[model samples]
Target chain A: MDDLSTVWLILAAAAATYLTRIGGYALITRMRTMPPRLEQALNAVPAAVLTTLWAPAFFNSGWDVRLALIVAALVSLRYPGLIMLAAGWAAAMAARHLFGL
Target chain B: MNRRDIIDGLKGGAVIALSTTPFAVLFGAVAVDNGLSIVEAGLMSATIYAGASQLVGIELFGQQVAPWLIVLSIFAVNFRHVLYSAAIARHIRGYSFWQKAVAFFFLIDPQFAESIRRAETGKPVSFAWYMAFGLIIYVSWLLFSVLGAWFGSMLGDPKVWAIDVLLPIYFLGLVIGFRRKPGFYPVVAASMVGSMAGFHLVGSPWHVSIGAICGVAVAALLPLPQKPDQSAEVTH
Candidate 1:
């Protein structure tokens, strides 16, 4: 946790991130083609990843978080852009005030 | 560049900005909670610009885990980006070196997703458009970090639990859009169930990655419908 160690940690982390992204580019460049199966997999990745990310938050949160998610989810179906902001902002304020979570 | 291309890039850039902001806020909060200074958090966000990896790194740092271990963990967690970058190669191969460099900056999940969606639909994928998208996301992520670091300090302990639901709702909306038909329902449900079960057993960060894998695997294995009889007579 000293200056040198911290610097090293940041550099390593950054390098790792860059390499992951670069690897994808490298693969595509080498292949020069995307098969249908791979295309389907790529299409599915975002939703699958996002869901995995979201589920833990829902279960980890207390009651207010659950409610906010439900409200946002319901309203987002109708208006994705506007409702997410409102829902997130409301959830933060409510969590701060109500149960003070 | 032409007017239409420039306009399209700008629009894509603006959307990227919106997507990056919340994540920046989340990152800032994580950094502070883990005992990093506001300046340090901002620097990390500005320098790295990778959200999930940053979050994982900070969490590991807080645990006093080995730095190399942290790096490796983040590398594994972000392995999926390899696939994402591969998907985006066609759009970037035509760009000059500088354009490719610039494109790398905005290559996070949301921008990549948007870019690929356009590609799948046969839209003209321009370097200018990709650069615009990356630049917008990059700037927004930086600003949001500063805001979140300041707010995280001012707000002190954000003890509200109910409000945590916003993200889930965001994800749920995505799930609804992805649902194609009865064919999709069982697979998606199975994935969700499997992931939830994983979350209950394991924990954060890891749960998300594991759950996503579970969901995708289930969806992939689900049997597709068989073709109807070719010789069947048509009924009026």
Candidate 2:
């Protein structure tokens, strides 16, 4: 694509993305309060979304990644966020080098 | 706006930034390596911001895919953000139109998660807090992407440093963070199983959205044991 077209493509993509971000809010605002079932569903969303994001990566990865995930999960019991992440990263690096993955 | 809110927002933003920075850097380096100019790569990151979609866009561009198709595919990949926006709409209801417009630009996954958590805690939702969280991640992401594009070759393979593991690990930590909440295990199980099936069957990033929808459906259908006091208080 030409330079101008490329710029237009990026601009169009940005517009589309902004629509997704704002569209849902606009729709929900029109409804005022959500129904109970919808509320339950929304409440479950974070866990569901996070799981969907992580599970494929966990299952598809090699032993090093799997081991790293296990380490992260175990560490998450005590240290929920950055600390767990740090430990997991360290463990993954260790597993990769040690096992030559 | 308050000191406490700023501190809280920063703390939340920093945690997410820690996980996301590597992904942004990797995207920058890879985009440059794949024939995009530094300016193009920067513009893509600044505009798209969503990591998975941006990566897909760069890959398709490298393959000489039509620009329209590239943009459409990225839109599909990021459609999940619509659901996120819907889920968090209640919290931001008080904000004016312009504030909401600007805030939605930074409505990435981490910001959504933090805002939802705050809302659930029954505290008044602070737009300032959410903006602070989003701004930190946004600025750092743009900065790191440029840095990566400029010096990415020196970093070698991102996988060599185990950068690939960061996201899944960080997300795993988030799933665990919900351990104390009611209905956690069942919700997580439904989501994971659904997502795995979607990954193997549906392909692409559709699995994440598919799994999320299935999880929400399943969780909503399950009968909850009575907690009259808690159940009486409605949550949005």
Candidate 3:
């Protein structure tokens, strides 16, 4: 593994994240009011990007993985992240080992 | 420098710190699972300090995605913090230039949400209090990441323990956390389909950017809700 490259990547990510953390203040300090569309776009960012991370995995995986994710999603609607995570992990373990899925 | 504000910040931040410990640990484990050294995992937690993005970055790293694309994905995932800073901007104007800079570095989701709630409830969002809150969560996140990485390095097969399932489930949880946001359903639906389709056609990492762009674009094109001022005029 290229440790140097990974370190650089981590630093770059941090810099980019920092840019976002301060980007809003820079914009607001310059402009009087933000356009409504811009606000809407920003609001939608979390769901949009996050869905990309998991949606494909859910689509591509087998019954065991699918079951785990489905259970997790269901749990997440009512429970917090930790519970949802635990439920999914348990489901995966059961499907893979006990049920032999 | 009100002592009460600092104390309150510490109390509130401690709760957030505890809540985020699992995630920091998860990130460390997943980071190692994806080929990062323990020190690299800690470095990511210490610097990026954003959980979801760190996980996303490591996953892309595991896939041998282009470095630039991985960085872009992290930036895109962390983009919501822009809104955090924007929303809290009015309250933190009293902070000096460097203070605001340091504060922005620590503007994770919980801090953003807490600061907003406190400000709305007539609490002063003092720099002293904000730092007190952010620093505790920051330290916990860093420490646990290294701990998880150390433990993760010792694990034999991630599949046996179903560790591979954790990231997707975690991301799913994050996606659900935003269910109440405007345009969330359509936006997520778009990203989901777009990403799956992109995974089949374009391939591993491009799917991320493609799907995200599709969702955000859908959000931009969606009809705007009536502004409060405009709605008030109509009611009157």
Candidate 4:
């Protein structure tokens, strides 16, 4: 794509994303109450999204990312802090380098 | 707001803001890897402020796909932010226009969660302090994204030294914290399984949306004991 096209594309994507953000707040501000169902649904959104997002990273190439995710999961379960984050990252990186994942 | 309230808000905002940096760093690296100019990536982080959208945009961009399709994908990926904004709207309704605008920009998942948490605890906070929380997070994201882009340029690839572990660690920690009720487990289980299934079956982005919706639906539908309200409170 040409420069103009790319820029336009980026602009369009940005606009669409921005509208989504704005619309939610605007609607809520107008409505004065969040529906129970939406609240219930929102509660699960991040976990589902985050998990799906991580799957490819975990399984990408072979199973190194998956193993790393498992290690991270364990570390997070126990520590649940920055150190755990480092542990998960370290384990993943080590495995990736060692196994060429 | 009083000084104490402002201070508390700042504290709340700072803690939440701190969490956004790592996410920005990842987005920064991804943006570069996807062939975006540093300026473009920085703007996306600074202005858009939605991580999932930015990430999806980069992925689509990397594929050299059409811009409209990328935009649509990002829209789909970030649809959840609407729910977030809706949840916070009541609290910010009385703020000045500028304050509302600024908070609108910074209101992402963590800040929204923190604000709702505060509201539920009966500590109704001012929009100004909430803006403080939002701004601190927004600025941190911008700085970290810039840094990440620069760092990514220098480092060649981001898939090094286990950095990929950040996502799971951060998310799982959040899940543990959020799932305080006994009834939350089924929802958590559903969501986790749903996400895995979405990835193997559906595909990117959609997997997230579908999985999350399914998990929450299952959780909401499942019968569970309801505790009597301890604190008399309202969300807005």
Q: Quick one: best lDDT, which candidate?
A: 3
Candidate 1: which docking quality band? acceptable
User: In candidate 4 chain B, what residue range of length 10 has the lowest lDDT sum?
Assistant: B227-236
Runs of candidate 4 with Cα error greater than 4 angstroms are A28-80, A93-101, B12-23, B90-98, B224-236
TM-score of each: 0.80, 0.91, 0.74, 0.81
Residue-wise C-alpha lDDT for candidate 2, range B1-236, written one tens digit per residue: 47788788888898787678888888889988887777887898888788878887778878878777888888877877888888887788677788888889998877887787888788656777877788888888888888888876777987789988988887788777767766778888988888888888977667877788788888788765475223322222
Task: Report lDDT per candidate.
Answer: 0.66, 0.81, 0.82, 0.67
lDDT of 1: 0.66
Residue lDDT tens for model 3, B1-236? 48998899999988778767766777888888888899999999989999878887988889968899899889877776776676577778788999998999999866876786687579999998999999999999999999989889565566888877877887787778777777889999998888888889987656776787789889989999865222111000
Can you tell me which runs of candidate 2 are displaced by over 4 Å? B224-236
The candidates, ranked best first by TM-score, are 2, 4, 1, 3
Q: What is the DockQ (computed on Cα atoms) for candidate 2?
A: 0.62
Clashes of 3: 0
The structural similarity of chain B in model 1 to the true chain B, as TM-score, is 0.75
Per-residue lDDT of model 2, residues A1-101, tens digit only: 67777778878988898998988777776774466667677677778888887898888988889988999899889776878888889988998888786
Report the lDDT of model 2 for residue B24.
81
